[model samples]
Target chain A: MLAKIHITLKKDVLDPQGKVIANSLSNLGFEGIQSVRQGKYIEIMLDGNDKNTATNKLNEMCEKLLANLVIEDYSVEID
Target chain B: MLAKIHITLKKDVLDPQGKVIANSLSNLGFEGIQSVRQGKYIEIMLDGNDKNTATNKLNEMCEKLLANLVIEDYSVEID
Candidate 1:
């Protein structure tokens, strides 16, 4: 099984890296970009076959180490 | 319009960050028993209405700034 996780900053938290990217894009002549937010995409291969188990493990992983719960949110998908 | 992009290292490239995460997960008692790969997810809010134009601009942005073409691959989704 494979678990795909996406971790993104909470809406209230400021993202300086994303701001830099937006500014760089504008400098590169790309216009009309109102805002940019960056996050993490993680792919984990598990040696299990059950989707339920994978999902549980993925959520645990996010809570324990993958995401900074105070400042970020994470979503998991199992396949 | 909104553009969501996922940038990932090519399969052949080594990802030290991901390795560290995997090791940490293992040490934390999470048994993955496989591999983990990490990537970037970016969301861009555009002040335009046309999806076609947004897609084009997004591709250009990825090629020019968002991704390192030599070792990373990126996919863009316009919404």
Candidate 2:
């Protein structure tokens, strides 16, 4: 099985990295670009397991290590 | 318009970050997890534009700045 997780900062959180990228894009003449927010996409391949078990395990991993729950949100998909 | 991009490393490359992460997961008892790969998920919100224009701009951004094209592959979606 494989797990794909997406972690993104909360809407209210300030993203300096995104701001810098947006500014760079404008400077590079990529017109019309506005706001940019960056995040993580992680793919994990694992031993065989049922869907529910994989989901539960991956969620625990997210809460404990993958995501900073205070500022970021994470979603998991098992395949 | 908003653009969401997912950038990931090519298969033949070494992924030390992913390896470390997988080890950490095992150490933390997140059982069954085998291999891991890490990537970036970026979301950019921009001014209104036709789909073609948005796509062209975003693809340019990816090729030029958003991705290390020699080692990473990027996919973009406009919303």
Candidate 3:
């Protein structure tokens, strides 16, 4: 099984990196860009075909290492 | 209006960052993790409801600054 994870900063968090990106975009002539928030996209290939197991394991990975739970949230897609 | 962009490495590219990340996952006891690839997810809020304009501008950003066209491909979603 393969899983894709999207991790984004919490709404309340101050995204300094995002702000920088937004400013850079504006300076680079992308004037239509109002705001920019950057995040992580991780693709993982797991061992077997058990959907439940893969989901649980990936969730564990997200919680343990892939994300900072206090400031970020992650969602998973499996195939 | 908002746009989401996903940037990923081309298959022929050597992903040393991904290799290191995969090894780190294994070392951290994520045994089921077979392969790990990392990418960027960018969320951009645009000025108006013109999806076509936003799409073109985002594509320009991707090609010019957000992604290395030599090794990365980017896709955009607008709303």
Instruction: Write one digit per residue (lDDT tens) for candidate 3, span A1-79.
Output: 7899999999889889989888888888778666789999988888889998889888888898889999999999997
Q: What would you estimate as the lDDT of candidate 1?
A: 0.93
Error of 1 at B58 (Å): 0.3
lDDT, model 2: 0.91
Model 1: per-residue Cα lDDT over B1-79, one tens digit each: 8789999999999999999999999998988549999999999999969898888889999999999999999999987
Kindly give the stretch of ten consecutive residues in candidate 3 chain A with the minimal lDDT sum. A26-35
Best by lDDT: 1
lDDT of candidates 1 onward, in order = 0.93, 0.91, 0.88
Off by over 4 Å in 1: none
Clashing pairs in 2: none
Question: When superposed on Cα atoms, how far off is each prediction in RMSD?
Answer: 0.9, 1.1, 1.4
* lDDT (Cα, tens digit) per residue for candidate 1, span A1-79: 7788999999999999999999999999999989999999999988869888878888999999999999999999986
Task: State TM-scores per candidate.
Answer: 0.97, 0.95, 0.92
**lDDT tens digits, residues B1-79, model 2?**
8789999999888899999999999999777777999999999997886889888888999999999999999999987
